[model samples]
Target: MPELPEVETTLRGIKPHVAGQCLRGAVVRVQKLRWPVPPNLSELVAGQTVDDITRRGKYLLLHLTGQTLMLHLGMSGSLRIVPDEIPVGKHDHVDLLLDGKRLRLTDPRKFGAVLLLDHDPYASPLLAGLGVEPLSAELTGDGLRSRARGRFVAIKNFIMDQKVVVGVGNIYASEALFRSGINPLRACNSLDSKEWNRLVGDIRHVLTEAIAAGGTTLQDFTGSDGRPGYFRQELRVYGREGEPCSRCGAAIVQEKIGQRSSFFCPDCQK
Candidate 1:
């Protein structure tokens, strides 16, 4: 799935081209996705200018004249800007028509979403229920610690909870925890102020670097420009299960936490 960095990368990649551009219309090749593409999507978006583009968690928001378009690139989806004359691929499911170009959405797995919102997106149930953005000012050590109180969940699962913090997916969670020198299996409330602070900083650092590198492309992720993310090459312990830890020479280990594969340096990450 496209995590925060990948979603942010897509937002940045397509915003420049789509913002302020009038949408001629939308073409929904298939109406069924993770959620059904709005039936009247073409009519709703037609002739409306995209006033702005932003991201909340892994969802992309295209602020139109009076409505908002919310998109979720599910398991294996990508957006691309291409000329109108370009031939659409089999997986190209939707297209937002522009003057002479189009913003195309390709979802091989058909798990992406295109929803038309007539009201405020941030006020909607979808965006309203989301946790604080991990990159925002609200994400501090103290705030996290407060939410973590009384939680016996593993640290990895605690951070991965969408209600506690948004956009920290499995891969980045492992990377951040590894950088924080905290074992993923540790209970969430076991951390002190200093450890919480360190973990918060490392989380921000890992996400910032991943965004700069265009996100981790372990399988199907790519920016709107159709470029694969390069951060996978820089992964510390996410996938190198039995490999030597980069910092401590001890073998990096993998285990199932919250039913998700988690990798950590057993020696370096205490």
Candidate 2:
């Protein structure tokens, strides 16, 4: 699945090309995605100029004058800008046709989504329920501490909770925990205000760096331009299980927390 960084990267990559461009048409090659691609999506988006492209959590919002299209790149989906003459592949499920160029959404696993929203996207159930964005001013040490007041869940799982703070996925969560020197198995309530501050900073630092590097290099994830994220090369503990820790030189370890494999430096992150 594409996490926040990848989603943000995609938004940044396509915004310039798609923003202000009029939608000539939309071709829904596959109507069934994670949610059914709105059958009349073409009619809704046709001739509308893209007002902006923004991200809330992992979802992308293509804002138009009066309509909004929300997209989720579930497990294996991506959007790319291509010339009109380019041939669409089997996985190329949808096309947003511009005057001479188009934005193509290819989702091999069919887990992605394309939905049309009549009103404000931020007020919709999808975006409205999300927690404060990790990069936003609302996410702070005090904010995290308040949310974590009585939780017994592992700090890893606690921070991973979207209700606590959005967009800290498996990869970045582990990396941020390692960077913050917090053991994944430690109880959330065990962390003090100072540690919460460190953790918050680490999450922001890691996420910003990942977005700059284009996100973790996963098997199926790539940026809009087919660029694999180089941040994976700098991972500290996410996938370095059983390998030497970068800081303390102790072997990094992995364990299941909240059903996701979490890696950390048992020595350094203690």
Candidate 3:
């Protein structure tokens, strides 16, 4: 699935073209997605000017004059900015026809979503329960420490919780924990102030680096321009199981925790 960086990259890539452009029309080639594309979605956005584009967690928000269009690029979804004359591919589920450009949504697995938000999208159910954005000022070491006070869940799982902190996906989580020298299986409540400080910094560092690299392309993720992310080339421990640890020369290991693969250097992390 496209995580925060991928979604943010998409928002940045498409914003220049879509923002301030009036929508000529909306083409819903297929209405059924992870959630049904709003029945009147086409009418709602037609002729409306796109004011801006932003991302919250993994969802992209297209801010229009009176409403916002919420998009979730599920496990196999991607948005591309293509010429209006370009032909749609097999998985091109929707398209927003701008004055001279086109924004197309391609979801091979149909797990993505296109919804209309008449009111404040942030307060909507889809976004209401999400936790602090890792990039925001509210996500400090003290904040993370307070949230983990009495939780017995694995520290990895604790940070991955959307209600605790948004956008810390499996790959980024592993990288952050590795950078912080925290074992992924450590109980959340066991982290002291020192560890929490390191963890907070590592999480921010990992995510900021990933966004700068245009996100990690391990699978279907790509920027809005259809470019594969280069961050995977800079990975330290996420997918280097059994390889030498970059920091300590120890062997990196992999394990399944909470049904997600976790990579760490035993000697370097605890």
- Give the whole-model CA lDDT for all candidates, comma-separated: 0.91, 0.89, 0.89
Q: TM-score of each candidate?
A: 0.97, 0.96, 0.96
RMSD of each: 1.1, 1.3, 1.3
Best-performing candidate as measured by TM-score: 1
Across 11-94, the per-residue lDDT of candidate 3 in tens digits comes to 888899888999887888899899898776778789899898888888889899999999988878889899889987889999
Q: How accurate locally is residue 75 in candidate 1, as Cα lDDT from 0 to 100?
A: 72
Off by over 4 Å in 1: none
lDDT of 1 at 34: 92
Clashes of 2: 0
Question: Over the full model, what C-alpha lDDT does candidate 3 score relative to the true structure?
Answer: 0.89
lDDT of 3 at 268: 78
Q: Cα miss at 93, model 2 (Å)?
A: 1.2
List clashing residue pairs in candidate 1: none
lDDT of 1 by residue, 56-171 (tens): 98899999999999999987999999999999799999999999999999999998899888877888887888888999898999999999999899999999888889999899
- TM-score (C-alpha) between model 1 and the true structure: 0.97
